[model samples]
Structures are given as C-alpha cells and as structure tokens.
Target: MRLAELSERSGVSTATIKYYLRERLLPPGRRITATQSEYDEEHLRRLRLVRALIQVGRIPVGTAREVLAAVEDDSRDQLSRLGTAVEALPHGPEPDESDPSTAVGRRTATALMRQAGWRFSLGIADEFPAFRMLVGAIAALHRLGYACDLPHLLPYAQQAAQLAVADLDLVEEFTTPAEQVEAAVALTVLYEPVLLSLRRLAEAEESNRRFGGGS
Candidate 1:
C-alpha cells in the first residue's frame, strides 16, 4: 500500500508515519519511484510494534530503538530476544549500588530471591531490571517500618513463578519467533493491570467473607 493507505490502516497520521520513518523506528519502505515508496505487511507489523512501545508502553524513543533492535535481532534465540526487550523496560530506575541504604535493600532482595529459589542467570540476577524494582520497594517498605520479610514475600514469589510459567506457556503457543516475542512484549506491558485488579478484587472478596462488609 501507499503511505496514505498505511496511515489509514494503522489509524496513525501520515505525518506521524513520516516521523517514524525519519526516526528509523519504522523501516524504510521499498522504493517505487524517486518520490514514492511502497509499504507491505512487514512495515505494518513494525509500525504496530513501535506504536505499542511508544504509545501504550510509554517507552522513550532511544529505549524503543534498543528494544526494537532486540526484537528484530534474528541472531538471538527467541528467549534471549524476549529477555533483551525486557531489560530495556523501566522496571525501575538504575539502582544505586554504592548507597548503603540501597545496598541494604539489595541484600534483602537477593535474600528473598534466594529463599524463594528464584533462579536467574548466574551473576545477572542483581542486574535484572525487576531486581531494582524489588530492591526499591523492599527498601521503601522498610523505611515505612514494615517488615519486608520472607514469610510475607514467599507467597508472592511463588505466584510470580507460576505467572512466569503461564506467560511462557502462552508465548510458546505462537509458532513463530516474531509472534511469540511480540506476544511477550504485549503481555508484559498490558497484563499488569489485569493481575493487579484481580488481586484487589480477591482481597475485597476475602474482606467481605471475613468481615461481612457491604460491596
């Protein structure tokens, strides 16, 4: 299709599509003439991914470039591609390992992972993006005078493990690496609210059962 058709199909403006091409977020279309280019399904797929990352995921352009590179890198296996994409996400800001308080949190975080047997790549667990998120949350909870102890965290960790398995199973349901990787990215960004809402609803039900409170 032409640029106009692409824009219409994607529900994005032609100006925005031009911007994406200029930014190299979307691959350049095939040259049909000196001034015009032809787009195909591949361009559409890439455009959708770019839009999802930038619009829905709110990923910065530089980060999206890195993530798109990771996603399109056919050299790596599918799992590696998924990991690379995940590493680019803002699970938490870069950790301050030098800060004593952050170090304390890191220790607790690692301890929790250890007790839960949450296996990770050797020496890379501490560097995982979510590791920083966990450390920050635990540290903040400690500052709030809450016990960020294993007993309280173990069930969450177990549930996370189960969720990971289920997520991977869903990813594996797609046969192609591209489809699987895209599913992983989409689910990672989109499903957190679903899980969080379910948790809250379950808590409410439990509260009602125990306290006999009105909805």
Candidate 2:
C-alpha cells in the first residue's frame, strides 16, 4: 500500500507515518520507482503499534523507539516474550518506606492501604499519600462515630481490583508490548483524574435521585 492508503487505513496522519519512518520505528518500504515507495502489511502493523504507543501509551518518542528496538530483537521468537516483559512493567510510582513511627497512626495507615488494594508491607504505609488520606478519613469518621470495620472494606478492594484487571485485559487487545507499557503508564497518569471526576458526577446524580423532584 502507499503511504496515503496506510495512513487512511490506520487512522494515522501521513505526516506521522513519515515521522515514524524518519525515526526508523517503521521498516523501510519497497522502492517501486525513483520517488514512489510501497509499504506492506508489516508497515501497517508497525504503525498500529506506533499509534498505540504514542497516542494511547503517551510514551516519549525516545523511550518508544527503544521499546520498538526491543520488540524487533524479539520478533523472531516463538512467543512474544519481550511483549510480556513490557506488560509486566510497574503501573504506578514506587513507595518510600523510610519512616519508623508506629501506634494508632500506623495501624490506620495500614488499614487504608489495604482498602486501596495496595499489597505493600506495613512499613511502607508512610509513603503513600492515598494511604495517609484514607487513614485520616477513616480516623475522622471514627471520631464522628461513623467508624467502618476493616472486613467491610476488604470486599470492596477485592472487587475494585477485579474490575481494574478486567479493564487492562480489554485494553490489551489493541496494544503491543511497548504500547502495553505505555498504556499502563497512561492509565496510571490519567485514570485517577478521570475516575475522580466520574465519581463526583455519579454522586451528584445520585443526590438528585434521592432528594430532587420531591422524592
């Protein structure tokens, strides 16, 4: 196929294809004439991968190129082992576990981390802002006589993890190994904002359902 056809088929811009060619992310095409070149199916597949990484994964071009090189080196294997390695990349920022304070504060922090589906050791509780926030929220609730039991939160955490894993599996269908890593990065960066916004919207609608229209 020609560059224009490839772009049209892949929903990628011609200029982006040219940029990928210049970056050597896509292999060279056939030289059909002095100026005209013909790209094949492999180029199309590679472009799909590139689009997933750049637009969906949001990877920096330099890092994405390195990831593509890894894919190339591993392309001949019976299994796409490098792709699996890429998907196994960490999804979020690592925690810092250097604090030594203990007692009620630490226990509350640990419980909140549990609620958030984080599986790190208790020693790392001081490192997660979400963990700390959860602790504070639960503590405030308790002081206001609205305390929740840990067991009650456990099921919610489990269900949430199941949903997240399902969501990642769904995204896997359209992504390559490098793009998988990129998508994971993108999910980590954007999911919180998106989910928080949705949560507020849902809460508003539920409030209307419960209190609005004189019902």
lDDT of 2: 0.63
Instruction: Report lDDT (Cα) of residue 26, candidate 1.
Output: 90
lDDT, candidate 1, 1-215, per-residue tens = 99999999999899999999999889899999999999998788788888888888888899888887888898998778999987877676665666566776778888888887766742587667788888888877766678777788888888998999988898799788987887788778777778889999999899998899656
Please give the lDDT score at residue 127 for candidate 2: 49
Estimate candidate 1's alpha-carbon lDDT, on a 0 to 1 scale.
Answer: 0.83
Q: Write the per-residue lDDT of candidate 2 for residues 1-215, one digit (tens) a residue.
A: 99889989988898988899999878889989988799987788778767766675577687667766665664545134434334332233332234322234347657655667577535455544445555555555555556455776566567667877865785586456544544444454456567779879988888988889523
**lDDT, residue 6, candidate 2:** 92
lDDT score of residue 27 within candidate 1: 84
What would the C-alpha RMSD of candidate 1 be, to one decimal place? 2.1
